[model samples]
Target: MDKKKRVIFLVDMESFYASVEIASNPELVGKPVVVCGDPEKRHGITLAANPLAKKAGVKTAMPLWEVKSVCPQAQFVRPHMGKYIEASLQITEILYEFTDQVEPFSIDEQFMDVTASQSLFGSPQHMAKMIQKRIWDEVGVRARVGIGENKIQAKMACDRFAKKNLEGIFELNSTNYMKKTASLAVDELFGVGSRMKRNLYKIGIYTIGDLAKRPLEEMKKRWGVNGHILWLSAHGIDYSPVKNDSTELQKGVGNSITLPRDYIYKEDIQVVLLELADEVCRRVRALHKRGRTISLSFRGADFNHPTGFHRQTTIPFATSDTIEVYQASLQLLEHFWDRQPVRSIGLSLDQLEDDREIQLDLFSHPIKKLQLGKTMDEIRERYGKTAIFRASSLLSSGLLFDRATKIGGHEA
Candidate 1:
């Protein structure tokens, strides 16, 4: 028997944060609106903007003042993370009603394996409309959905092609994938980033068609396994599953931030490291997992390597305590620091295992610190993360509260 062609839908919320704002206040509909961080404190970066503002060249991450200059009539609003998260949950629930294989790619995007639902629901194209209509009817947020035979094609189609179409839905398969994507720039592919694009350009591979024609073995030899993956992605050959289980999907729990400004002092760097470690460990614990390896990464203000230098160290036992992870990360940072003005930092917990048991130390255990961390987690979960923050959060360079209100480094 031939393998069943998978039907995947990459459902992305259209201008999600702004849409939610419009949904809440119908008067804002069809108007140019921009969601951003605090504008007064110089942290006001454009997080999302409606199509009206986008048409006027209002781009995300541009300074709010510049956005105002571009579209003076645009209405700027602060992000309400709680509202967006609630809407996201509602969207997820609606997707679940259609299929059990809905995998949330981000707060505003989901990959749904609807192959099994074609018989019960109509065709994949029909299902996309149904899903979009339901989300708009129920949550009042518009969604752009792309349908394809696999995840990669679905994502690329949604991001590149579907978003440009008026219907907000598109379908691509083996037959038309090449014609649709071949001549596009290599950077437009799902997995291709700026560095990869530059490297590909150096090798005379500036287009998807160029990448598709490269010999896989030579590409792999040149860019290692990642190169081969990129080459395959260019040809729309992804076979990765849409993982629904949170535990199965996460290889690590991590977070990184490009600071609002560069940190020139070691104290400021330490503050950010501790805050990042706290977040990573809290997430690891929330998932009921612990990791033996803790990694720290940072980059200088120089934008040469946006990905940055990352280093990890393995401890004797698995743990999710923020202090332990922070201490481990501190060692990595100390060893790896090149003394350039640090601009960003990241922390991660890998080598994961179920946090089911803890082995007692031969001589002593840091029971007090473990208990304190657990207490803080409970307080934060109940009252809000900002309710009980560390003293370091008081530092001018700290971004604990700012980060708490954002998702993926933008207004949530």
Candidate 2:
């Protein structure tokens, strides 16, 4: 028997952030709209909206007050995570109907291993068409799918051709490869980011072909593992396989962001750190997990590399008490939080445990501690993440936070 080849499919929701908003209020249909941060509270930032919003000169992460100044008619709405999650689940359910081997990459992207279903579906194009049709017909949302021999190519195919509706689906067997994959900026390729582009630019490498045709050893010597990965992608060589769902307990949770501009002030950096800690803790509590190791990472303006520090404490539980983790993380940050300008910051907590190991503190009012954490989480969950927080944080920036916890004469 002839050997069968492996195949992968990538499904991406079309303007998912905006689509969810439209679904919420039918009146917003075909009208300019954007969703993101609260604008009225002086921290309004655009998160997602309709194409009409895009044409009206609004963009994601752009301050909404500025957006309104430019386009007064544009409507803004807050993102509804519950609704987005529902839509994502519904989309996944539809995908499940097509194949059992689906892996969710994010809220709007996934990979489906369809090697086994090829025979039953007739052709990859046929399968793609049906999947696309099913999504629009069911959810009133459009998606683009890419079909290829490997995961990388499949995802690239989705990025290159995905139109507003099912227009993005590309089967290497059915569509001309160059017609889709070409015209894509080298930086647009997955795993390549702004920093990587600078390095490539310095070397006069501007295209996939430029990187693909380079010497493997030379590229590895210059770029390390990342360089080699880029070269492989340039030549359309990818070997990653589809993964199955695994509930292995997590050892840590983290959140990070790159500022549009580098920050130089010590206070500003601390503020961003606290916000990151708050975000990280929310995710940890959501998963009902605990972490004992806290770490901090700072990326320089040059983007040369990131420097970080980690410290572990035997906190008998994984509580969402930012006070505990904040202290530990801040202690580690003191070593690196210098006058140096930083472009990005990240936080992570490792050494996770289940609820079985949870215990209350002895010195503090243990019952109050537990009750306060539960009450705070409930308030934040319902009212919003920033519904309650240290007032000093607002006086500072939303970027970082520090704890008053001091250990061994070190700041936490």
**Cα lDDT, all candidates:** 0.86, 0.69
Candidate that scores best on TM-score: 1
Q: Candidate 2 clash total?
A: 18
Clashes per candidate (backbone, < 3 Å): 0, 18
lDDT of 1 at 196: 85
**TM-score of model 2 vs. true structure:** 0.70
Write down the lDDT that model 2 would get: 0.69
What tens-digit string does per-residue lDDT give for candidate 2 at 108-216? 8878988888778867788888888888887777778888788888877777655433466776532354445445677877788999988887987776656666798
TM-score, every prediction: 0.85, 0.70
Q: Give me the overall lDDT of model 1.
A: 0.86
Clashes of 1: 0
Compared with the true structure, model 1 gives a TM-score of: 0.85
lDDT for residue 98 in candidate 2, whole number 0-100: 75
